[model samples]
Target: MRPQYPFRVRHADVWRIALPACIAFITEPLAGLVDMTVIGRLGDASLLGGVVLGALVFNIILSLAYFLRIGTAGLTAQAIGARDPADGLLHAVRALLVGGLIGIGMIVLAVPLLMLSGWLLAPGDGVREALADYFYIRVWGAPFSLINFALLGWFYGRAEATTGMILQFIIHGINIAGSIVLVQGLGLGVEGAALGTVLGQIGASIIGLMLMLGHYGGLGQIVDRVRLGELFQRVALKRMFGLSRDLMIRSIALQATYAYFAAQGSRMGDIELAANAILLNLLFIIGFFMDGIAQAAEQLSGKALGANWQPAFEEAYRLSMIWGLIIAIVMGFGWYFFGPYIISLMTTRAPVQAYAVQFLGLAALCSLTFMPAFVFDGILVGTTQNVVMRNGMIASLVVFVGVAWLAQPLYGNTGLWLALHAWFIARGIIYWWALRRIRSRMFAQ
Candidate 1:
């Protein structure tokens, strides 16, 4: 019998990759959860407020480098599909080199970052000082974190989800343990939380790089030709910067939208912000789980595109949606059943808990369309449909801001929650159109 050159795409691929990757993604957020827990344990709302505010600032900076992982994933997946060994390795190298430069740049801007964070967050001196400490310690780890983004992105791009999963486990496991030790045992407070984060990211980056490098035989293969050339050869550099630039635009818009959410919450006061922090994390789980399907689609679609297997390319979406909905429904239950217990445990204030429950409840509703949006996002990334993706995100942001501004004056906190939930729905609708358009164009040929 002839060899079946096109192997079947299994649901197991998603579970195999996404389950650990999902757990890893979930646990990675635990670092923030840890910070909130430790700080909340202090019996100081101010501390809770400061940590949440500080962390938001930290993520905004980190989010800018998201392209390093996402763009790398698209390029790497293409290599995997083609069975071409060269592109994947070179892809990893490109990401790592870029990661190093970002690290240095982060350090140089550290002081200014603090100044800017203070200016933007506009907390009084006491909160500002604590936030500054958190910012400084976390900032020092920028190189490691950014590099990890690149490495992990490449790993996912190649559908080597298990490697990224294990790396995340090791990273978060150490970070969580370190956080409890420093914050509780040593009484390091806010700074301890920051220190734990840095150590965890640094340790994880080291391990992730080792595994990723060793995954494809060894680095010697990459070192031979790549070392001799102009590191930024025009054609290659153009692709890197071009993809990087577009992805960066997408990240900025997405991050800015979240920033808008946080900034709006800040104006409403701390309990509202804390409640939002809790609620957003619950909503965030939807994205994490959906990414499993989306990423699987991303890998499969890229492979299909490379092979020009129109049927498999088409099958990827149908396959992704079927799987995506299942994961979202499971997470939604996790939210509805257990979320209140978790949120109540996190905060001491009655109003905070009340708001949290309400917001989380609405998140459950918001996620009805979450899976589709995510699967579509992966499709876009896989297709290298950056411009459309960017446009979709921008449109979503406008809807979000417009709705929030219009609603908040009338509904107060409830209005904010409503706006938040509606934003996801709007995102789902707009991106669905974009993805469908791509599907049509791909097949129309």
Candidate 2:
């Protein structure tokens, strides 16, 4: 007889966690899609390009602080797995404090950040002016956005995917409605789009906090349970800081790869940049869809590790990969068939639409490669193996830079897309290798 696997995870169990998270994740890019669609319909490629560049700048900056979400999720999942609700709450509180401080710092430094990004992107006068208008308005939402990130992370870590989904819907739904009104109805253009996003973020932050308080049996109980002295003890602080530091490094590397991609496209011209932005939105949709499965892996694997159940971890890993692969294949086929139609719907500009269609095939292929990389990210984050994660991202980024340098001069934009695919493949391979080396060490304990 064939040897049996250690355990089997039910399809229902995986989907129970994944479906809601997937819905939540898709809403994020859905909001972006709305923004792009509104700006694209304005009959000015420069406006679209400006929004794209401005969004990129915000992503690079805000994503650097994503450790607040990631670190909290990993730590809280493990705590919950251990049946330590108080400890989980402690992790959430600490993460919120850090996120709040970081958000404030971002606001304080917004001017320099905008100036530096403007200098680096160096768009044409029209695009530059639009970019400034968008950035100046949207930067104020940094704190609330970070707070909401922590809230979503905390909810997911607790295996409350439905609640997370509701929160995400609230945020993005308001964003979509507001964008439609401000950009299309009021004709405020890019600045209105930025304001709509900021308003959504701020509103979500408030509602999320209220829900969190209700879940924890009010503010008094939460405060009583979270002993500041113990929570911020030297040892606890070290562990939290260490995890955040490593994740911050990993995030910086990942963001740098995309930032480089966008900067290069900007240099190629406004049409090329706008085309790439459309394609990149498609990539984001794929990434977020895959991230839903990754989120499942994170919770299940972290719980297994905390409970000292090796078989559970193995089962979680197996099922996550299976589902991730299936979804990625479906997405790839869908993109291959319907991508041009989707591009046409976003913009009336024929050149931009045509250029995006030319690259749609490459984007579809990249989606297939994203599966392992994204799932492995969830597993590592769940395990709080930040050092390994950081190292792997750094290695993949080096490969991306090297590949882009060698290929871009020869093949132009196609070469850049090729480099992006290489980056995804490289990340998957490196993380797989690292996981293999660490598996026995992690489980044997």
Candidate 3:
């Protein structure tokens, strides 16, 4: 049987995936917002600073491991396009096993990881105690959190965005509720916030397992049908691992750029660091919307490739880019109008609020320059063009470093924002050129 929906990409088809994905994407940052808002209200910049530091470390770690989600999505989406359920299921399962093992490793090495992060980040003295408390408790959730990544990737590849959205809602909704109750109601501080997020991850992973079972009819049938020997097939594992390795390297480079941004901000002052963190979350909020459209590109492009339908592939790329640009424009204006109010709401500290307000424009402008990279990334991932993705990101990181080095010394934090935009622009251009060159070779045969 063929895949459902028209082969040609349509506006309605793109939104069918993008809308729900967009909603799902924002929920994550909203959860982060909830954490920031809860910690920020305490009137202690140090506590908020500590949470920021702890969160930054987790961000880098998760980013490094993000290949579990991305590689699985590309492989499963290809399997889906080929109408190979067995292969698709195998990809997801493999990713889950890998994610679980990585999570366990992270837990075992939690203390060392924390020590390394503290040394590299060199956070202010005021934030160290709270950061330690938050980091220690949060490491317990690593397994659940990583497993959830595989589950979400499975759904995305299947074009079951609604299911993915519902799962995200469950996880982030629980996070929001738990953080409020634990931190605000119980006054457990940064520890409460960390624990709240952990609870949400655990709850989602259990529910996701049930949903997986239901998808395949039942546990008994799946156990009988799935062979252990085939599950560890070398060819498939090598492909998955190779893709994951490149993606992992790509992710580290990307995260390192952002980490540098945070580290540099921290050096200026606690208030500057806190302000940048608030502003950074808003940037993430803008990014989530664009990323939602990117999800459309991932599924549609992969499906088209699997079917060997160039027309469908072209349509997917064109429509995805159009929608991404539209959303970027809207978000840019929206941020310009409402960013200050949102920043004020996130933090009551006068200095932090003022600083964030002053820099909001630079962040808003990011929507325009950064939108292309997000959309391009989806297509690259969907097509399983891992080498191109890896090379593009590394090149972009070089651009980021060069720009920052030249600009930061002269213009301060504003220069850092400019460097970030330069990176985004470089990525978009590199991907655009690479894809154009690849398309001829990919379909010419």
Candidate 4:
């Protein structure tokens, strides 16, 4: 360790985590942006709709498996903070093993899962058929995708932000470039785009694995270093499961609720659905930027917890909030002022355009309320404050459903978005309340 800001207990530790993450996440959208551009040029509305549905499929499967990363980061942070290399290595091993299992399971269940997704979303004929094509081709990358999640999560937990940044650039970069060439140069259409995405993921996973070989010591050599009995132990598995369990519960609740909002949009009409999707992706510009800082909080707080040093934890939290709020305020204004232009860039539909204006207005309003909750989430995860994270999200889920019922009837699609915005505010409140345990202390005595 060169003893940088985060290492020296310096301020701005959150930036250390967030800056790279934000940059990485920003570039990440390039692939999707390119895909959408290509699909848009296809001159067929069905093709566009199919890509949207395909995205939903990918997000659903990948989102459910997010626990691999969350669990790895939390545990890794603790180990790093405790100054235990063994802890880091073991956490990495566990995440890889779990990721492997998840990937295998998903592959086997692909047919049923895709079928279920189609039935659940109830997409119309054109979109449904297009989505079916995208799903089949893209789902082949399941194993690599899961492993990549583990690699990123493990690195993030260890506060190795640069590694994640490098991998993301390579991964998303390939995805963007590959999609462009396949879809445009080869004229493979939507299928080409999907294949490009899968190839990009596989390539990124291979690189990540190679990095593990020397970037931190090959993840594959674990058995030789430790007894087989140790790897399969009940206690170790239980701890990983425990952390993942809480995160899975939170993710499921939060994700399912978001899906509900999406379904609500669908019910309102395709115009609303299209508008919401554009607005939501635009919002990602802000959310992903903030996610970087939150990722930082997770690493710093987890390590602080392991060190049993309350002061470092406070420093990490304070810095995360500082950066999170700054990004929120600045981005909120940007979204408010220039959002119309951003939305206009995505589609040519006039009705969808009209509705997007209203939807974006609400998105800006919620940005303030949303940023803290997001950053705080990473903090709580790092602190292994799982119970509050889980419970608080569940509480907000209820409010979201309740408000959606009332608002959707009165305000229609805008009301549905408003309901979600409220849920965002509530999400922050819960985590802010939960951090009381270590918030009061400046340092360990």
lDDT of 1 by residue, 1-445 (tens): 2111254566676566666667777776777788789888998776677788878887888888888888888878877776765657777788888988988898999999888888877897778777877887888888998898888888888888888888888778877888899999999998888888889889989888778656655677557646536455678778888878878887888788777888788899998898988788678866776767777888777766655556777677677888888777777888888988988786779999987887676667656656777888887787777777777788888888888989999988777777766767777788777766666564443
Clashing pairs in 2: none
Root-mean-square deviation of every model: 3.5, 4.1, 3.1, 3.4
* Candidate 1: C-alpha RMSD after superposition: 3.5
Once model 2 is optimally superposed onto the true structure by TM-score, how far is the C-alpha of residue 17 displaced, in angstroms? Answer: 1.7
Per-model TM-score, in order, reads 0.88, 0.89, 0.90, 0.90
Candidate 1, poorest ten consecutive residues by summed lDDT: 1-10
lDDT of 4 by residue, 14-125 (tens): 6677788888888877778788888889898998889978986788778877888887888888888877757587777778878888887887898899889988888899
- Best-to-worst order by TM-score is 4, 3, 2, 1
* Per-residue lDDT of model 2, residues 334-377, tens digit only: 98899999999878999999999988898789878878999999
Q: Compared with the true structure, what per-residue lDDT tens digits does model 3 show for residues 1-445? A: 4333336789998999999999998888778879999999998998998898898789878888898887778777878777785648888888999999999999999989999988987888888888998999999999998999999888998899999899999899998999999999999999999999999999999999899999898888778877888889998788888999999989888888888888889987999899988888778878888888999899889887776678888999999989998899998999988988888887889999888889888888989999999999999999999999999999999999999999988999999889999999999999999999998666553
Worst lDDT run of 10 residues, candidate 2, spans 1-10
> Which regions of candidate 4 deviate over 4 angstroms?
1-8, 124-129, 216-221, 269-271, 358-360, 411-414, 437-445
Clash numbers, per candidate: 0, 0, 0, 5
The regions of model 3 sitting more than 4 angstroms off are 1-6, 39-49, 122-127, 184-189, 264-278, 343-362, 410-414
Q: List the residue pairs that clash in candidate 3.
A: none
lDDT of each: 0.78, 0.87, 0.88, 0.82
Q: Name the best candidate (by lDDT).
A: 3
